[model samples]
Structures are given as C-alpha cells and as structure tokens.
Target chain A: MDMIWQGIHDAFSLTIQRDPAIVKAAILTLQVSLSAVLLATAIGLPLGAIVGNKNFWGRNIIVIFFRTGMGIPTVFVGLICFAMFSRQGPLGQFQLLYSPQAIAIGEFLLALPIIFSMTQGAVSSLDRRVADTAQALGAGPIRKLVTLISEARIGVVLGIFTALARCLTELGIAVMVGGNIANRTRTLATATALETSRGEFARGIAMGIILLSMSLSFTLFLAILTRKKNSEVTR
Target chain B: MIDINQLHVSKAGKSICHVHRFHLDVGHRCWISGPNGSGKSTLLRVLANLEQPTSGSCRITAPAIDIVYLEQSPFLFKGGLRHNLSFGLKCRKVSRDVRLKRVEETIESFRLQSFLNQDLRTISGGECQRIALARALILEPQLLLLDEPFAELDLEYVELVNEIMSCRPTMTVLMTSPHRPPESWSFDHLTMAKHTP
Candidate 1:
C-alpha cells in the first residue's frame, strides 16, 4: 500500500513536471495510433458498406474472413509484421522494421478487422427499406452508398472509436514492431511495459495513467453521444 | 406508362403473386385492390423496379429519374420534416434555390408547414404519410408507385391526399390498398386475386 501510494505520488509529479521521456512516448503513441486508425477507417468503411449492402458472390466468404480476423491475436500480428519487415523478409527492402512507421503499419493491420467487422454489422443491421428507399428516390450506386453510410453514421463512428481504443492500448504490436527505442519509437504501451519490468513502478504507472485517461475521455464522449442519440430517437 | 405481361413473383418455390396482361397509359391513375397477401404491394414493387419478377416482364416507359415509389409505412429520413420532404430533390441534384422553392411549395401544398420544425420521430403517422407523399410528388415523377398510401390516415388527411393527388392530372400513379379508395378518387381499379396452389 505504501509503495502504491508512493508510485501514484511520483507518477503525478512526473506528469506535472512534463518528463521528456514520458511526453515523447505519449506523443508517439498518439501519432502511431491515430495514423493507424485513420487508415483503417478509410479502407474499412467502404469495404464494410459494400459487403453489408450488396449481395454478390463470395460476399459471405469475405465477411467471414473479416470476422475471423477480428479475433486474431495481436501477438500473432506482431510476429507476422516482424517477419515481413525483417532484413531477409519479402518487404525488407524498405527497411521499415523497428520504426514508428512499422508500428503504425502493425497497428493498422490490427485495427482494420475490428473497424471492418463492426461497420459491416452496423450497415447490415439497418432496415431493408433504407436501400430500397434510396433506390426509389433515384439515387445512383454511389449516391445510394453515400445514403446508406449516412444512415449508419452512428455505427461507423462507434467502430472507429473501438478501433482507436484497441490501437492505443495494444502492447504486443507496439513493443515488437516499434522496438521501444527511447525518444525514437517508444510509445506509452511499450514504455509502460518496459518501466514496470525494470521495477520503475512510478514511470510505468504514469504512462498507464495517461493511456487510461485518453481511453476514458473517448468512452465518455461516446456515452454522451449515444445518450443524446437515444433521446432524439425516443423524443 | 406501365406494362406487365404474365408477371410472377415467388419465394422459396411458392408463388406469391401473378399479374397477367395489365397496362396503364400515360396520365392515368390506377388503384390496385385485393385481400391481404394478394401481392398488391408486390406488384407495385415490380412496377417500381425494387423487385424482380421470378418470371416475366414489367416495363415502365419513363426516364428512371421520373419514377418514385413509396412503401406502405413511409420511411422518413432521420432529420426534421423539411429534410425528409426535400430528400428526393436533393438526390436529383437540383440547385439549392430551386430545391428550397420546391420544398416550400410542397410543405404548403401538403399543409406540412406546422410540422416543419418537428423531429421526424415525434410526428404522427398521418403527418409522416403526408410528408412522404409530398416528398414523392416534389420530384414531379412521371410514374409514382404508392403502396398503401391511405392505411394510417384519418378523414382529414385522406381527403387532403385525395385532393392533392387529383390535381396531378398528367402524372401516372399506381397505388395499392386492401379496401376501396374514397368515392371521389376516380381511379380505375385493378383487383389482384390471391394465388392458389
């Protein structure tokens, strides 16, 4: 109990003093996670809309693939990314290993399936009349898709939030691909792990606090948005 | 104008509705009447091109943009009354001024001005149905398909719809209802018999 109190005290002090290492790690975490989430949303939203709205051949297979991907272990993704970015691997010519870009790439892969599956579920669950209504209103294919996406905007936003939460806190991909090089590639998650393993409880707790605060802010905002939406629906 | 020749719609090898040799010329109003599950709505869907007949053809001789279909329970887009009323015009890429002008005219025509600021969720069923009809009419569609447009309206709205529809003398309309329409409607009736075996 004494140690935990001391650690909490020191963590707050470190955060207040703006420790450069902690700041750097937090910034890198934000940069990498945000980049990963943006890329995932860009690709996932359209693919999800297509898969959810259309009934072409192999759509079920593709949906199944994405659903399976959502459950894939982050460590497994890290291992595959590590192999691919290693010097002797297929994509090694770019020499991206152990860099922030590598971390972003790994996180992007980790976040894609989550966003895709959630968006697909959101869009597929919409009333069947939405598509028919759009069609009946003379919307072309592109316009119809835009309409569907607009109607399912709440679900799409939730998917993005979920992806960002996952990417921000995931440790395996960040530690493995980012290599936790101080000031260069270290992120909050990796830095927390490293500090805790080195018996620096205060530093670990500080990074953990920052990560928790960020996630909590998002969750709070999501709660407010959903509450407002529900009220509007019931009004 | 619309034409249907031996149209058949089925689900899971069970025949639901069939229409044999039906034709409506331009500027004509037709009301389809039948018992429940008689495919009145299905036939309207075929005319709207929202569904494909299991076998046979349904041909509408109008620009696709000039066709509109309203479901039985009209779907109001998630927004204020004005947004739902102007949705179709926006789809056609009408200029903002023209769109606003048409929307205002529709609101006035449908007496929906009172509900302009109201949220779609808070509106009554009759108001929703009228707004949906106004939304469809704002496009000035050459061919309009309405599925049970009068299902949830009181006498006032029923007369309002009848009056508004009576004014569009040149527009082609195909509507479905389980019961006969008002005596003042002047619509040619097409009764769909229930499918057997």
Candidate 2:
C-alpha cells in the first residue's frame, strides 16, 4: 500500500515533468481513441437518426439487433476483427490485423452502438413537427438532416465523449487487435497491462494515472458542453 | 388548387380522417373547423403531405410547390436563430446572399431582429413561435398551413395574424381551428369524421 502511494506520487511528478515516453504514449492513446470515436459517430449518428426518425418496415428489427450488440464482449470483437483482417481472411490484402488501424476498427465497432442508440433517442424523442417544419420549408433531404443534427448536437456530443471513454479504457480489443506493440500501437490501457505483467509496477501505475487523467478531462468537457444545453432542455 | 379524394388517415387502427372528397380553388382561404377528435390536425397533416393519407390521393395546383407549416408547438433548432431561418434556404439551393436577404426581411417582419443572435433552444415559447414564423416567411412558401398557430401568442398578437397572412399575394393560407372562424375572414369550414373501428 505504501509502495502504491509512492508510485502514484512518482507518476504525477513524471507526468508534470513532461516525461517524453509517457507523453508520447498519452498522445498515441488519444490519437487512436479519438479516431475510433469519430469514425463510429460518423457512421452511427446518421444510421440511428434515420432509423429513429423515419419509419419503414423492419426498423424495429434493426433497432433490436443494434441494442443487442451494445453488450458484446470486447474480446469477441477482437477475435472477429482478427479473423477478418488476418492473412487467410477475405480482407487480408489490407494487412490491418495487429496494427493500430485494426485496434481502431475494433474500438469503432465497440462504440458504435453507444453513439447510435443515443442518437436514436435524441431524434425520436424530439417533437415530430420539427421534421415537418424543415420539410415544409422546402429544405432538401440534406438540409433537413443538417437541421436535425444541429438540433441534436447536445446528445451527439455526449455520445461522442462516451465513445471516446469506452475506446480509451478498453484493453481486450486493443491488446488482441494491436498486439500491444511497443512504440507502435501501445496505448495507456495496453501499456498498463503489459507493464504490470512484467512486474514494472511504477510504469503500470504511470499508465493508469494517464488513463484516469483522460477520463477526468473527458468528464470535465462533458460537464461544460452539456451544462447550458441540458438546463434549457429540461426547462 | 388543393384537391383530395378518398383521403384517409388512421393511427393504431383508429381512423382520424376519411374526407371522401374536397377541393380548394386558388384564392380560396379555407379554415378547417371541427370538434375535438374530429381530425382537424390530421386532415391538415395529410393536406400538407407531412403524413401520408393511408388510403387516398391528393393533389395541388398551387404555385411553385412552396408550403409553410406552423406546428402547434414551436420546434426550435439548436443553433442561433439565423440558422433556423436559413435552414430551408440551403435546401432550395438559394444563394447565400439571397438567403441572408430573406432572413433579414423575415426577421424584421416578425420583429425577431432583437433575438437573431440568440440560441434558438433557449427562447420562450412565444419567441419560438415568432422564430417559426420567420422561418416560414423567409422561404416565400406559397401555401401556409397552421395548426393552432395562435396558441402561444399574446392576445394582442393574435389580431395581427391576418394582416401577416395577407402580406404576400402568392401565399395561400390554411388554418385549423376547433372554434368559429376569425371575423373579417371568409373561410369554408369542414368537419372530419373517423370510421368506427
């Protein structure tokens, strides 16, 4: 217990000192996680918006499928991505497995449902006339979509931060898909795992500190972003 | 002219509108009047093409396919008021300069210039209704559909609605009310019936 506290103090001092390796790892983690969250949001927000806003046959079925996917194990995603990106697989030509890109893809799949369902809730819960107003304005399809997205921006930002946190914290998919390659795909979560296994308590503690710091930053931003928006929405 | 034959609308196996036949010629200002549960709003929704008539067809000979729908509850976009007003312009492929001009005119018309830069979502209900009016007028829609447009307005503002409706010659107005028509306005009142399930 004493050693853990000492290691935590050292981690903070090292982080404040701008230690090159820790900073680099932090940047890499952000790069991979942000990319994944953005990609997922891009794909999921519109998919969820369309599904939730426009009614067509079988929409409920698709919603059920997505809702069911929300709780899938990260290791299962890693395994599926590995199969799809391996040399013997159909997408072998891409050679993405065991790379940062593969990890990003895995994270994207993991976060997709989070962003999608939130976007679905945002769109469907809104007054139906909002869409009608846009349509009656002769707003084209794209214009109407932009209007809807703008209206749901608060929910989207929340969904994005949620995706980012999930991506950064997930170790199973990153480890399997990225191989936790040093100086390549090593993120804070993966580095923590590797460092702890090698009995390097100090290094693992530093990485854990970075992970917690990232989460804190995310939550702070979410609070600032949603404070005013949420107050008005509630009113 | 707006024409409908065999128009039908239903929800949860309950029919809302079953207007067997109706037609509104040009220069006709029609007021949809009915008792509660008589499908006045549903009839307007079908006419506006916002919702499909479950089992019928409708056509319009109006000018340029332009329409404005004033929803009972104002729906404010999340951005500044200008974004809400100009959203439809982008869809019409109207140039930015033209859009800005119309926005300015509409803002002045509805006395919303004071709130132009305010975030739309934060405004009061009456203010939101004014924003909706700005959005509707900015597009120069030829047909105007109002679903209880005066619900959130101050009593003083209600009298001015007719004047606002008459400003543009090409604009045709349709308002649905559960009470008698406004004085000084001639309207063909219609009642909607639902088929018993």
Candidate 3:
C-alpha cells in the first residue's frame, strides 16, 4: 500500500513538472491511438456494413472469426503483428518495426475487432423495418445503408469509442511491436509499464492518473452526446 | 400491371403465402385485409418482390419497376428530414434543385414543418408513418404498396390520409389493413379469405 501511495505521489510530482519525456510519450500515445482508430474505421466500417446485411458462402464463418478476434489477448495480437512487420517478414521491406507506425499498426489490429464486431452488431440489430421502409421509399443500396447507419448512430459511436478505448490502452502490442522507442512509440501504457518495472513508483502512478483522466474525459464526452431531451437523468 | 402465379412460400417448412394465382391491373386501388398472422404482409412482400417465394413466379405487364412501398415505420438517415428525403434523389441522379423542390413538397404534405429538424426516433409513430409516406411519394412511383399504414393514426388523421390518397395520380395502390375501410372513404377492395388449410 505504501509503495502504491509513494509511487502515485512521485508520479504526480514528475507529471506536474511537465517532464518533456512524459509529454512526448503522451503525444505519441494519442497519435498512435487516433491513427489506429482512423485506419480501423476505414477498414472496419464498410466491411461491417456489408457483412452484416449480406449473406454469402462462409459469411457466418467470417463473422464468427471476427467475434472471436474481439476477445483475443493483446499479447497474442502483438506477436502476430510483430511477425508480420519484422525484418524477415513479408512486410519487412517497409521497415516499420520499432517505429511509431509499428505501434499504430499493432493498435490498429487490437482496435479492428472492437470496431468491426460492434459495428456488425449495430448494423444487424438495426430495426428491420428501417430497411423495409427505405426500400419501400425506393431508396437504393447506398441510400438505404446511409439511412440505416444513421438511425443506428448511437451504436456506431459506441463501436468507435470501444475501439478508441482499446487502442488508447493495451501495453502489450505497443511494447512488443513498437519496442517502446523513447519519444516515438512510448505511449502511456508503455510508460506505465517501464516506470513500474524500473521501480519508479511515482512515474507509474502518474501515468495511471493520466490514463484514468483520459478515459473518464472520453466517456463523459460520449455520454453527453448520447443524452436526449426529456431524459430521466436530466430531470 | 402486376401478375403473380402459383406463389408458394414457406419458412422453417411451414407455409406462409400460397396463392394459386392472382393478377392485379393498372390504376387498381386494391385492399388486402386479413386477421393477424394471416400473411397479409407476406403476400404483399411477395408481390413487391422484396421477398422471394419458395417456388413460384411473378410477372409484370408493364414492369412496375418504378414502384415504391410505403412502410408503416419511417426510416431516418444521419442528417435531418431533408437528408432522408433527398437520399433517393441522390441515388437516382436527380438534380439538387429538383430534390429540394420534392422535399419541400413532402414537408408541406406531411405538415412536418415543426418536426423537420428532429430525429426520426424522437417523432411520434403517426409522424413517422407520415414521413414514410412522404418518402414514397417523392419517388413518383407508379405503384404503391402499403402495409397497415394507418394502424397508428388517429381518426382525424386517417380521414386526412384518405383525402391525400384520393389525390394520387394514375397509380396502382395496394394497401393492407386489419380494420374495415372508413365509411366516408370509397375504394375498389379485395379480400384474402381466412386460411382454410
């Protein structure tokens, strides 16, 4: 208990000092998470929409795999990503390993399932009547999809937020694939890990504080967006 | 201008719609009414070609390809009412000016001025249905199939809808309902007798 308290105390002091190292790490973390989220959205959104509404050979199987991927261990994903981006790997020509891009790539994989599966769930759970209604209105595939997705806006946001949270945390992939390179790949998660392993309790505690704050702020923003008028909570 | 033949549909090996033969003509105002779970909607679904029959064929005389189905529930897209109305126009490559004109007409017809900016889910069921009707009308469909559209409407609104339906141009309309047509309203009606199987 004292160790934890002392670590927190020291962490806050260092963080408050505006340590350039800590600031750089925080920026890197945000960059990686944001990039991962954008990439995952680019890949996952359309895939989820198409997969949710259409049926084809192995469609069920593909969905099952995506859902299963949602619960995948971060380290497992990290290892896979590392192998793919490693010097001897197929994508090694890009030499992305140990770079911030590598961390983004790893985080992208971690966030992909979160975004894709939730999006799929949202699109599937959309009111069947919406599609029927759109079709009856002579809306085509693109228009119908746009309408359906909009109706399921809350669900879509939840999916994106879920992916963002996952990307923002999760140290395993960043450490393994990104090598936690200082001022490059060192995210809050990586910093937390590094501080703890080095017996730097205060720094670890500070990272924890920052992570908690980030998470809370993000969730609060989302909650505010979701609240509608005449909602009981407002009353 | 719609022809359906030997339409047989079953789900989980249980029959749904099994019409030996039926043909509907152009400009025909047909009413399909039946008890709950009697597949009235299913029969309409088959006619609309939205759902495939287990084993049957449906041929059209002049191809009601430009037909529209007015759903009981309105489906809203991401933006405002204008966005939802203009969506079909965008798909069909209609110009912006034409789309705006159509959307404005629908807004007035549905009396949706007050609710135009609100989300679809936030509106009343009656309003949603009206929005659905507006969306279908803007398509200029030659054929309209409605599924229990007035189920959620008030008596006054129902009368109002009848007045509006009367103004529809030379178009084939097939509306299904559980209640008898309002006495003040007149139409060419048909009945799908209760299942004997």
Tens-digit lDDT string for candidate 3 (A106-141)? 888888887788877888887777777666656677
What's the CA error at residue B109 for candidate 2, in Å? 2.8
Fnat: each model in turn = 0.45, 0.45, 0.37
Off by over 4 Å in 1: A221-235
Best by DockQ: 1
Count residue pairs with overlapping backbones in model 2: 0
Candidate 1 residues A1-235, lDDT tens each?
9989999999999999999999998899999999999999999988898899989999999999989988888899999999999999899999999999999999999889988998899889989989899889888888888878878988888889988988999889887877889999999998999999999999999998999989998889888987786555422
Q: Higher-lDDT candidate among 2 and 3?
A: 2
Recovered native contacts, candidate 3? 0.37
Tens digit of per-residue lDDT, candidate 2, span B1-197? 78889888888988877888988766667887666777778777776767888898888776434766777786776656777777778777889999888888777767776785555556788878867876776776777788877777776666665667666665667787666656676667776654565
Model 2 accuracy (lDDT, Cα): 0.78
Clashing pairs in 2: none
Q: Summarize candidate 3's per-residue lDDT along B1-197 as a digit string, tens digits.
A: 77778877788877766767777778777778766666778877876767888898877654434777765555555456777677667766789898899889878876778766465557778777776666666776678888888888887767766777778656778889877786555556666654544
**What C-alpha lDDT values do all the predictions have?**
0.87, 0.78, 0.77
User: TM-score of model 2's chain A, to 2 decimals?
Assistant: 0.90
